[model samples]
Target: MAHQSTHETVDARRIEVIAPNFKRRLSGVTTTIVQLVPAQRADGLEIAALGPGLPRHLPKLRYRDLWRLRRPPQARAQRVWHARRNTEMVGGLVLRDVLRMPLKLVFTSASQRHHQPFSRWLISRMDYVVSTSRKTAGYLERPSTVILHGIDLARFRPPGEKFAAKRAVGLDPNRKIVGCFGRVRRQKGTDLFVSALVEPLRANPDWIAIVAGRTTEKHTGYAAELRARIEGEGLSDRILFVGEHTDIERWYQALDLFIAPQRWEGFGLTPLEAMASGVPVIATNVGAFPELIIEGKTGIVLPDLEPSTMQEAASRLMKDDGMRAAMSSAALAHVAAHFSVAREVAELRAVYDAVSPPAETRAGNAP
Candidate 1:
């Protein structure tokens, strides 16, 4: 009964935009929706999220509310259904074709690889498509507007004092900190980061490294093995696996350097997040890392997944305080100019405007 009331309330709210997240787990796509929905709303777009596992603070559409898409809401423009995942794309097709919802389906593709036939068919049905990067756009059979992801600058700004930030997070304030954050698994290059930092961290007593983020149930053994390696090297104190953090921006603020050693990625955002927090990064040339990092300015970009490559880059950055400081400044400036959430939202608004129905059509269908 309570759920039914909530559905009616959401239905009557006249959501002009619907961002769907069919996946329950908080993935990169889910994170994007959570961050961008509010920013879109702040820009005077009546955007609401639909699906499970989203936070309650954001406006949400219940399953029943999908029915409203069939008839234009009284005071609203035509609805834009933004989909990121394959499942959401499929659902949007059913609503738009089978039920004949007055929805403009827009899909944002982040994957850089070739798609299967099933996925390609879904892509063919989108009214418009957006790619998160140029590389992502290359994978699409149809032309797509390239719009890179952006970080919320306000939430990810640098702390006034790095040492104080470290101390606030129960880390050693005196040590120079480097961080590798994300899921702890082989594909994410957790072992690569651990191996690269082990020797460098051991040699430099003043330096400490952090491996933040959790290992899934399947990857528990991998995490344990990495821990054992750190313990065996007698660098457990210096190389810490502090696990997953809720306040990840604080961790980025506390770092002098950040490393993204992923072997492969669809589109990694940690490098941008680290840069936004005024820290330089060392990232492998995978996904959009090469495009995001300004080599010799914001951070170094390595060509391979070799641990020695990351080690060399990290060693160089660590040894030169002046270079690190310059890179940190450049990193912050680069992000502010090119990667803020405001920029992403504005670009997305343009896409929505281009694809959404005309005011007259919307008004004509109004209840």
Candidate 2:
């Protein structure tokens, strides 16, 4: 697909924060930059993104802009290099340690596992570290600020007419739509989500399920196998694989329940998105699912990763009108109170401030 940046690249001298996307693919790390940069800029931070796959509204910094970073931006001695990936950390090191640019390196880790030696070494070189969740913080080589991710509330919100939204998405307006979104791969537990829905979908004619996400060349076979299973169950029509959508917020509006069925994850965001859209979620006990869900309130966190657990909970919630409605209201309220994008941006800004202080506070030139 063709991508463009409508917002002109910000001048290097004016930027205090330089958020980079080393990987071009639409992964979680890239998604974070896309969502956070505009909000941070709106809050009056001198932030500009670096690298590809970012939206048009986000201010970007080009490859040639690095030369301008030799001197610091206007108000600080050093610019903040915020990296979520190892490659980005390497770039920061090249600019700071090798080329000797006035940059304060910061790395944000979302992984739950202990870091490998090389990663730990790179992380040790950082001026500040941020862990996306408290669970994520536990795996870090050094102390980190636990700043949970938040959604764009204006984009992912409760639709006034839920049934109309389903129809708008070309789904059955009468049926309760249960959706599983994200990349369609085994690690994501797409097969598990499909299996769980089969018995429930067959038993409950009023409900239908949609699997929405990208299926890359490598995962085509895996996705095809999952489709075969759905067809075998004679649920080809009842279970739909609508592929990925740019406007996924509308899919959230059409959902009665959302499921994050990942077997493992690094600080997942789908549950938070669903709740923000006023849709209850049934997520697996993995990643930040436990941290994100308000068990028996906003959503149900499976006690185990078993498909049976997901199946039972999904089936029960689809049938319980009172419970789902109450949870839906509670989910929306919880996100607005705790997980708006503004909150995430503010917390991150705090981290950036500590390392790259204002010009008045600096005693000498940055190292």
| Highest-lDDT candidate | 2
By summed lDDT, the worst window of 10 consecutive residues in model 2 runs over 358-367
lDDT, candidate 1, 103-170, per-residue tens: 88999999989999999999999999999888999999999999988989998989998879999999
Q: Taking the candidates one at a time, how many backbone clashes does each contain? A: 0, 0
Looking at model 1, residue 179 earns an lDDT score of 93
In model 2, pairs of residues that clash are none
lDDT at position 277, candidate 2: 93
**Top candidate (TM-score):** 2
Instruction: Summarize candidate 2's per-residue lDDT along 94-179 as a digit string, tens digits.
Output: 99999999999999999999889999999999999999889999888689999999999999999989889999999999999899
> Per-candidate TM vs. native?
0.94, 0.95
Clashes of 2: 0
Report residue 172 deviation for candidate 2 (angstroms).
1.1
